[model samples]
Target: MSLVYSTETGRITPEKEQAQRPKGDGIVRIQRETKGRKGKGVCIVTGLDLDDKALKLVAAALKKVCGCGGAVKNGTIEIQGDNRDKIKDYLVKQGHTVKFSGG
Candidate 1:
């Protein structure tokens, strides 16, 4: 066991992050979450094995395709709206294994 969080910086280093994501058979899961959004919806994309920079790049492409505003936080990509099907197709065409969850 080793310390991943740097007390001086008050954050976890890249190598030891990603502890929040639950992993399984290696497929990305895109789900629509509206629980805390005041009735609006946002697509939560998870299970991507990408570092911050790479994830941002992918998020940019998805945002372009969806034509909406979003952000990447805590290793997950949040796209604005219920664009799960569209995103699934785009990711498949881009060679990423993906799955959809939620309504």
Candidate 2:
């Protein structure tokens, strides 16, 4: 497996095969929720390969594009708000096959 990093972003993809897999390929669905203190809400992007460095790159790109604070944990990218379209567009432009889930 080869590790690839996006030139536009500093995010890294550890394995090429895993990154090209169909199981969880693409921009994920995001849901908004106001939980925890001060009712701070967040958007959740799931079905990603957490251990893969490529996914980390994807997460970082999404975060930068949305200009929001987020993280990659539990194999999911959690942004601060709904940014499905932005993430999808960015992924497509980066030349990775993307599959969008949820409404």
Candidate 3:
């Protein structure tokens, strides 16, 4: 076992690493969530089996298509506003199996 504190290094601690997202089941699901962010609705895209860089690229393309500002958090892409239909169309064009998860 390693000591939590070290006299020579002051407070010894491990470096924080980026969270690793689990692999998806091939099917992609898109849902809308507004629990946080003061009631602003965001489309949550999940089940994309892509790495962080690729995920960001996909998110950028989605944002461009929807003409909105959004972000990639964890393994999901959150697009601003209610753009389900537009997102679905784009994903379909990209040859992805997309489905609306929540109502």
Candidate 4:
């Protein structure tokens, strides 16, 4: 009998790369409020690693999972609406260590 095992070569496919990226530590607070000219309560995801592309990907994934509109700016993901629990749960399921911040 022969056994086959895959080693950690850090080689991941595009789909897998998107699915398996490690989310940084800390509780990302989701803030829904109309700030400045944007007259809409936007869900904001903060406390992410300071990486441009990573932030964008995280925001996109969260938006897809929550079925809402969002964008990444100033190192925060501004999702539309208050889906804090949903986003946190989704991130955790996606192999990310998540924490909840704010009330």
Arrange candidates, best TM-score first: 3, 1, 4, 2
Would you estimate the TM-scores of all the predictions?
0.77, 0.53, 0.81, 0.61
Model 1 Cα shift for residue 24 (angstroms)? 5.4
Best by TM-score: 3
The candidate with the higher lDDT, 3 or 4, is 3
Over 4 Å off, model 1: 1-24
Residue range 6-99, candidate 2, lDDT tens digits = 7786778554444343456444455565567267667776655446697688778888899988887666777787676787687678665566
Q: Candidate 4: worst 10 consecutive residues by lDDT?
A: 12-21
Worst 10 residues of 1 by lDDT: 15-24
lDDT of 3 by residue, 1-103 (tens): 8678888879878778877777788999999998977999999999999988999999999999999999999889999999999999999999999999988
lDDT of 4 by residue, 59-97 (tens): 888899989998887778888877888988887787666
Give the alpha-carbon lDDT of every model. Answer: 0.89, 0.67, 0.93, 0.71
Number of clashing pairs per prediction, in order? 0, 6, 0, 1
Ranked by lDDT, the better of candidates 2 and 4 is 4
Best by lDDT: 3
Candidate 4 stretches with Cα past 4 Å from truth are 1-25, 37-39, 95-103
Q: Tens digit of lDDT per residue, candidate 1, span 1-103?
A: 7566786877665564545555446788999999989999999999888878999999999999999999999889999998998899999998889998877
Model 3 bad stretches (over 4 Å): 1-18
Q: Supply the TM-score for candidate 4.
A: 0.61
